[model samples]
Target: MTEPQAREIIENYLEGYNLFDVAGMLSCLHPAVVFENVTDGSVTLRTNGKDAFEAQATKALALFMERNQSILAICLNADCARVDIKYFAISAIDWPNGLKAGAILQLTGQSVFTFRDGLIASIQDIS
Candidate 1:
């Protein structure tokens, strides 16, 4: 895909994520899409295939009462793009460490997306 098209696909996916629209997000991914989440330089979660990814997304959404992502920047090259985002979420649970329900949390992260046939084939998230 062209650079603009590839970027648009990523943008759409992020928009879906902010909206908690599972179907919309899934529409941008390939059937065999792989999603990896890394924390502290270690792989924390990995979901393979569209079905698995959908389940993971649903579970994540359920943990937050509200969630949003603002795109800080995007760099596109060929069929890949690096997206920097400022993510915010309000937890639905009260944690033992004093984080209470409805408390907001903010994080800055980057997602690397690889596209195949105009759909996202793989995504790796680092925060």
Candidate 2:
């Protein structure tokens, strides 16, 4: 796909993610896609395939009562894209101590995605 096409795909995926629509977000990933997260300064999360990614999302959805994410920007190349996202979270279902009853934590993060055949083959998140 061209650079423009890759940008559009990434933009659409970001929009879906902001909505917390797991299925919509998953549609952008290839069947054999792997997603990794490096939040704790270490790459710990590894979702080997789409199914595994969905399982993680399921657990997250059940854990958080409310969530909102917004895309700050997107940089796209021929076969890759990076998106900056700002998010707000309210984990009412499992609120830990030190946080108020309905605490909103604002977070800024970035996601890098490598595309193959117009679909995401790999995604790595840095927060």
Candidate 3:
């Protein structure tokens, strides 16, 4: 894949994600896609393959009443793309940890995307 191809794919994925459109997001991924979420140097979530990714994404749909991910910066090579992100969301329901519904969540993070067969093969989100 070319750098421009990677950028377009990433943008498409982000568009789907912001809209909570799981199917659209999946369209940019390889069938064997691997996904991970890293927080403070530890892996908080990992999903292997599209089925697992779909399950996770579907579950996440209910956690936020609103969500958006804005790309701050992005660089892409044939093999991969790295993006800095500003994320904002509002909780849809109370959490066990005392986060109440309507609470605002905002954070900055980085996401790495690797490509295979002209599609995203892996995504690692770090914060």
Model 2 Cα RMSD, Å? 2.1
Local distance difference test, per candidate?
0.92, 0.80, 0.97
Give one digit per residue, the lDDT tens place, for model 1 in 1-127.
9988897888899889989999999999999999999999999999999999999998887678989888899988887889998999999988778999999999999999999988999999999
- Model 1 backbone overlap count: 0
lDDT of 2: 0.80
> What's the residue-level lDDT of 116 in candidate 2?
82
Residue 17 of candidate 3: its Cα lDDT? 100
- Weakest 10 consecutive residues of candidate 3 by summed lDDT: 73-82
Q: After superposition, how far is residue 58 of candidate 2 from its true place, in Å?
A: 1.5
Q: Model 2, range 26-90, lDDT digits (tens) per residue?
A: 88889889989998689978999899988887677665567776779988777877889887887
Note the residue pairs that clash in candidate 3: none
Candidate 3 lDDT, tens digit per residue, 6-103? 89999999999999999999999999999999999999999999999999999999999999999999988769889999999999999999999999
Q: Candidate 2, 66: how far from true, in Å?
A: 2.3
Candidates 2 and 3, the one with greater TM-score: 3
Model 1 residue 111 distance off true place after TM-score fit, in angstroms? 0.5
TM-score computed on alpha carbons, candidate 2: 0.84
Strongest candidate by TM-score: 3
